[model samples]
Target: MTAVRIEREIERKYDAAADFALPDLTGLPGALGEPEVQRLDATYFDTTDLRLAARGITLRRRTGGTDAGWHLKFPVGRGVKEEIRLPLGRAAKTVPKELAGLVRAYTRGRALRPIARIETTRTLRRLLDAQGNPLAEIADDAVTGQALDRTEPVAWHELEVELTAGEPGLLDLLDERVRAAGASPAGSGSKLLRLLDHR
Candidate 1:
């Protein structure tokens, strides 16, 4: 079994217009880094009956980023989740045993299968303190999603600000600034759930 790593994710999402630009965040307590671009592709898995989705548990295999691998996220609270990650070791189209075992309570012996695929073109920037410590990361995403049903694919633009080494209050401060610039709070909790039209 490969090593399993755990992390806490605290982030917020926003829906953006087709022409939305990232607002000036330098006015806050940190310095903004140069923007980096990445193309990310991910496939989300769930039981046919959608048991995991109902419980807010997500398992996905993703590639094309610094953290490319298999990720299983469990909701802890609003805007908070505990993420378990494992390396991708030639197991395309297959969920790793370690990750599967973690969600067995919800899966209840049912099989997990690919339910949706999401492709993202991401422009990422980091918010750093005067000391050069990372405070948070802002992602501007152009996303396309399609369910396994093979129906029409949907696409949209969204923004995310995730805490790295920052305090929780930083989110609230950014929230006001981001909204003043015209982005609305995300109507959906996650990209997968939005893709599956759960919310």
Candidate 2:
């Protein structure tokens, strides 16, 4: 099965503290929901020499959380990306045939191998409008990364506030708040990129 999504994920990342307190989000469209917690483990695949990462493309197999499967994300434009998701059935560490075919142009006969693994403990707080519609989500994540073929493990904490059904301006509002609560903006492309850079 093939599924495509036009994802407009506008968010900011910040350096997290051990005892980080999230800023008040009740001032948003509606109010914040009770925090929902989950653990996410994702392994990213890439060609040696990092061809895919150089071109802002990412392929990963992730388990846990609301969406657990294989995802191929490619940059479409600034702050927006296109994601193609394939379900996990009998496939193990091998990349699914269908999903692999989609990135043939990038692989170009090269092998795709696991480059990095990031495990995160996420706390999700849904921001809703007065009509009970989802506006955005605030994710506070504590991450541990293990780079493939490498021995050292890297660990860090980050906060992401992604706009869901909310207006783009909501991110701006949230960014201001998160900054006030002492979060420094992250400079990496994604969690995978951040993990690999430490190597």
Candidate 3:
């Protein structure tokens, strides 16, 4: 059995155009490093009625990238979430019992199944302090998602800034820069919810 690790995630999302460019942040408290690109494919699971999504919770099994595994996220508040992660192991197309049990309160014995598939081409840049310590990660994602009930896929571009070892002002500063770069705040809570057209 793999041990589950939980952490608090503080991040913000924004909607961008296909040709959007990142704003310059090298002159902030830290410098922005060269971008690292990764391709990420994730399949979200939920009951047919989307019980988990209704409550602002998400479960997905993802491959590729540095953190490929099963992830369960619960909304803690605006721009904050409690995330639980488990190793990929050998599981495929089947939700791990450990993760499923964690969301049983919402599932109420309902069967869980794949509801959406989202693929992302991510360009990641690290904001680093003078000592080379990471302050935050800026992810520019080009995403395509297919909902179980939809015949065609939806595509969009978004920016995500996740805090690492930075103060709250770091997020506020980035937000100003991102908005000035022509990216608006994301309309949906997540890719899955947006794809599934939950709200």
Question: Can you give the TM-score per candidate against the true fold?
Answer: 0.96, 0.92, 0.97
C-alpha positional error of residue 44 in candidate 3 after TM-score superposition, expressed in Å: 0.3
**Candidate 3 lDDT (Cα, 0 to 1):** 0.91
- The candidates, ranked best first by lDDT, are 3, 1, 2
lDDT of each: 0.90, 0.83, 0.91
Please give the RMSD of candidate 2 to the true structure. Answer: 1.7
> How far in Å is the alpha carbon of 68 misplaced in model 3?
0.5
lDDT of 3 by residue, 1-199 (tens): 5899999999999989999999888567788888999999999999999999999899999999999999999999999999999988786789999999999999999999998999999999999988998899999999999987778889989999999999989999999999999999999888887777732
Give the alpha carbon lDDT tens digit for every residue of 48-75 in model 1: 9889988888999999978999999999
Where is model 2 poorest over a 10-residue stretch in terms of lDDT? 1-10
Count steric clashes of candidate 1: 0
Q: List the residue pairs that clash in candidate 2.
A: none
Superposed on all Cα atoms, the candidates' RMSDs to the truth, in angstroms, are 1.3, 1.7, 1.3
Clashes of each: 0, 0, 0
Residue 103 of model 1: what lDDT? 90
Cα lDDT of model 2 by residue, 110-150, tens digit: 98888889899999998888787788888999999998879
lDDT of 3 at 153: 88
Candidate 1 vs candidate 2, TM-score winner: 1
